[model samples]
Target: MSVLNETYTLSNGVTIPKVGFGTWQIPNGDAAYDAVTTALKTGYTHIDTAYAYGNEESVGKAIKDSGIERDKVFVTSKLPGEIKDAEEARRHFVETLANLGTDYLDLYLIHAPWPWNRIGTRHDEGNLEVWKVLEEQYRAGRIRAIGVSNFDVHDLTNILDNAEVKPMVNQIQYYVGFTEPTIVDFSQKNGMLIEAYSPLATGDLLHNSQVQGMAAKYGVSVAQVALRFCLDNGVLPLPKATSEAHIVTNAELNFTIDPEDQEALRHLSDSAPEHFHNSTQG
Candidate 1:
């Protein structure tokens, strides 16, 4: 069977596709619509988007147009991080459902512990308030699973300590060089799955000689090597692609990296741009 057919069960017993298509830079309208349609047709069952991405409407349209059953596709969206109040979180959740033209999302996430512009400013009390709203939504069946993105250990602990529902996943920048092991370990230990975004390090990993060597050894694209590395380590990789070839190639994960190579890939130094830290560190 194709790897795209595989799944990982969350702590809540919700099954999510192992590989997901991320709609981050893809804008709304025809561009986002076409990209998501192409991904669904190419065998991607999981689609990741955020309100911050400004493309949920197009993403929803493509899924509706694909002629696929809604239950077969896992749709994920994130609440805007600026929402620190329960009422605002509830309002945005409804808007997101309307934007996606869906009554319930497969997964909903707090985009970040802090607002995008206020990275590193730990807003524990505010995040807990937003998380409480998420818990209410989840209990109401508006979301199948609840999670957080770009959250660090401190941020996650704050929620875990006070949340009625623990986060099921923590999406972060996990790649060959930039694997935040401390956070990854904490999430896993606490029964939260680590969803890896930018598994290819946003195309920077392709240039790394070590990554290239592994790709050559496995006879796969560097993108494939990077993604498979995440999968092998039990991380769900969300690789973004607008092209059909790249989207199709990303889900082709039948090859496995040798154990020795996996260790090397894990310890590889961070090659991500400086701005990535500024944007992702929460």
Candidate 2:
């Protein structure tokens, strides 16, 4: 069986595939449809999209046309960053459900604690309000799991202090050189999973000499090394791929990284040239 068949159980007992296909920066219509279809055909069971990605409708169409049973494929979408009120969140949730053509989502997340352009703005009360709506929908069975992306400890603590249900996952910018040990530990200790987005650092890490050296040593693609690093460290990785070969290669994680190599990867500093901030610039 493909390694895609492997899974990680969430806090609430929902089973999420260990490797997920990410749909960030993928335009809607044919591009999104084709990319998603390729991933599904290549054996990826988890699909991560967001309202911010502007491709949920196309992602949904591809999934519907693939003839895969809905239950077998775990679908995830996120609320827009701008939605900070309970009513607005409910409205967007329904719209997302309609756009995806799914009655329920396997997972849904608050795209960010603050709006994209205003990353550090205080939104604790606003997030709490929106989380209330998510809690309501989750209880009504409209979503199987609910979470937050880009949330640090303060943001996560706000929800934990006031909400009835705690977040099941915290999706963030995580990879071999950019791992946030503090957040990872906090999430795991509190029964939440950390879903690593940009596992390739948006393609910058692929060219790092250190990463390339490790990949060459292991006889795997640099992408595989980065992703396997996350899995070995107990974080789920969501790697975006648009090509069929890459989609297939991203899931072939049957090898292990030596303990010492894993430690070196874990200790790679955020100040390193290949870190997330340096590579994400336009």
What Cα-based lDDT does every candidate model obtain? 0.90, 0.89
Provide the global lDDT of candidate 1 against the true structure: 0.90
Candidate with top lDDT is: 1
- Please state the error at residue 145 of candidate 2 in Å: 0.7
lDDT (10s digit) by residue, model 2, range 63-100: 99999999999999999989999888999999999999
- The 10 consecutive residues of candidate 2 with the worst lDDT sum are 273-282
Q: How accurate is candidate 2 locally (lDDT)?
A: 0.89
- What stretches of model 1 exceed 4 Å from their correct place? 273-275, 278-282
TM-score of 1: 0.97
RMSD of each: 1.4, 2.4
- Work out the TM-score per prediction: 0.97, 0.96
